[model samples]
Target: MKQGVQGSPGKPVAARVPAQARPAADGGPYRERDASVRGEHTHEERPGAGQRATVQRSSVRGQILDALRTALATGELKPGEVHSAPVLGERFGVSATPVREAMQQLALEGAVEVVPNRGFRVVERGARELAELAEVRALLEVPVMLRLARTVPAERWTELRPLAEETVRAAAMGCPAGYAESDRAFHRELLALSGNEQLVRIADDLHRRAQWPPVRHGRADLVADAAEHMALLDALAVGDLDVVRGLMGEHFAGTG
Candidate 1:
């Protein structure tokens, strides 16, 4: 069984919100700044008319994809449920084209499957499939973590304290979507310290899929899982390889 951090709560750790999700300076909805060099150009120097339309369509598709993923993680889109692009487009105040494009991406990710002449059905994952995913994740991450435990400095691990605490707080809030996002943020940050972007991307994909299944456990189970983040950090900070190994093993096992 997985072990959790015991005893009373520690001092509050400041949460680190992702920059893209943070409120804008003017208090408007958070908008992703265009990173392309085109952003430096004036409206006159921007892309051609058709190119502009393409960019707008791509942005809409991306937004719909993010929203759909959130819905899947939160159980708003239940397993084995079928959702039509037209209906989803109406909900998002967009046309069916972008929604269909986004759902196609989800299909490629194995989160949903296309139904001929119908719609996409959220893939119903069984316990065995989830266990396989957990096993693969453990295989990929456990060794990387062990190597980092030996090489990364204690101060580096200390820097991640806020992210770990954020997971705990998100879990306590009882919102699976919030907890899922925070949980991924913590893991992604930790893996990124290895300076391997490809590894982080692959692990993130698996993590997102694991979150698609409805959370079968209650709030206490979530808190326990979240507590392991802090505990893992503690072990890493002290260079305790044995503790790190144990915690990582149980942590992935619990996800099965």
Candidate 2:
């Protein structure tokens, strides 16, 4: 199994993996393609009633990825439970190829592991490990955000308000899967304003690791967390570097 980023209390920590920038402007090592992030579809519908059951989506692979993410978030796909591509493909009513592809991408995201002949299992992370991850994210994201907040111009911060609000809406969705994706997008866009894809990619990995088996977390927590994004944006607009720093540090403190 692929090991955890920092590992839990007793688990062995793996060597830090460098973040690969997606779609590096010069076409670097990072693979630019992620089916789920393709923005190919807005909504998914399960067809039936008068018509035959059909999976309506712009990309079959994207749908599979979304389903897997939702399953992970909802505990439909529990951590440490191995599931084969064929079985998962049948569950999603698709061929094994797409399932395997989606699983491979998830593996890169530090969400799952390849279990030899056995299929894949979500990596189980402990509370301490998750807190460690939150610390790393704050270390990487906060300083850069504060630096940008000072020099990025107030108008730019104003422009990013929509993305921050988007995160709030996603959190208000009251579903882990939807909120996770939007939260990722909001942070990614916020970081991208720096014009550094590599930084954004590193933050992406940290963000992905922050989401794991939540222990009975509820909608109220999520809404409050989403509101934090707005708080960050507001602080940015206010041009208070110290406030931005404090907000960012506080946002990640107990986040995981």
Candidate 3:
């Protein structure tokens, strides 16, 4: 989460500009300038090509990281399983270099551990660990949400209805990764209202970690969890602190 409010869900929140209208992260006015400079300069004077290559590699790494995270969330990359970069690369139709880089990132995130001669091993988080994560997340988010319920305008909560609906749609799809991503998106949007960047980042990290451990939640349970998002928005829109608090508790508890 960032400073400015976004008009829609799944859009970048840092910029006031709309998602489709926002400039590319790597290419924009700078890219246009580079193109103009390239037309007048020799090959030796052009650094844009190398910079663009670096950005392309970085983009591939990011895509691989996201796919790996989704796999972890869905239990496609099972806990206690060793996944080799080369094998994962084959599965993703890329080379081992980017896959290895992605796995290194996942290692830093505590989702996997490097095995030296082998590849990465998915960390086997048990029930207690998952519960502790949920508890900590609740501790971090519940109070903030309560505060928001008291101070945030009803219309602000109303504006988030689309995000809540997105979560419901994801849940109904019965795809764990889809639901997890949507659930996080909803929470991140809600928490961003506090205007605390560090809090939002920390809480989001916890939320992502909580999603890594596989759970036995069925589609029905997922739908119930998704329903709570709407219920929370409803309570917040009406400024019902009691209902908000109760829903928040149930939401975190159900997640664990």
Candidate 4:
């Protein structure tokens, strides 16, 4: 039998369980990792002045991608196991075509591998690769965030406090997916203050991929991580570039 969420401590890997992977003691459906983040944080996107069809297509794609990400995050579809497109299609209440397409996108992101005649396998990453990913994200994010911390008005940073707190609430509630989504919202909104769409999107992707290490055996780290977001804003509020720089470094380091 596949290990439900975690394998033996010696391996530190997760594998696929049956569709009915038992919930934790909290009555949640799955272990609280990416338990259900995207589903919790709803985004309101209105169709633009025109191009309704285009907007609809994008929205559908977004939903499929979110579902796939959740499955991967929650360990519903585990690393090193091949999963067929139709099975995922059924899980997300979508058609196989879109699931296949989304898996292809994940393949490009190094999150999965396309298996000829089989479908796709979640990509298993090692500690070295995770560290490398962290380095790349820090290199892309740290400099920009530092500049923004000093240049952006203090009041603007204050605006992001609630989102940070929301992350803690989600984590406390054992909603990994919710925490992931809110955490993304908090960071994306914070980065948006930089007025650079490309940077925001890039950092957002890295943050999602570099999920904050979960509470392996307790909730202390989860609460601590949530507080870190607020502390970061506090640093920015004081216009302390040195403190902001230090916080940014430590924050990025913790992701790996």
TM-score top scorer? 3
- lDDT of each residue in 152-200, candidate 1, tens digit only: 9999999999999999998898767778888889999999999999999
Per-residue alpha-carbon lDDT of model 3 for 115-229, expressed as tens digits? 8887888898887888888899989998999899889989999999999999899889888888988898999999999999999999988887877765745888889999999
Q: In model 2, which residue pairs have backbone atoms overlapping below 3 Å?
A: none
- The digit string of per-residue lDDT tens for model 2 on 166-231 reads 777876778777777788888898889888999999988888777766542578888888888888
At residue 168, give the lDDT of candidate 1: 91
lDDT of 4 by residue, 70-117 (tens): 656555556687878666554544445556777888887667898899
The estimated TM-scores of all candidates read 0.77, 0.74, 0.79, 0.71
Model 4 segments more than 4 A misplaced: 1-62, 90-94, 212-218
RMSD (Å) per prediction: 11.6, 13.2, 10.5, 11.3
Candidate 2 or 4, higher TM-score?
2
Name the better of 3 and 4 by lDDT: 3
Q: Order of candidates by TM-score, top first?
A: 3, 1, 2, 4
Worst 10 residues of 3 by lDDT: 13-22
Number of the candidate with higher lDDT, 1 or 2: 1
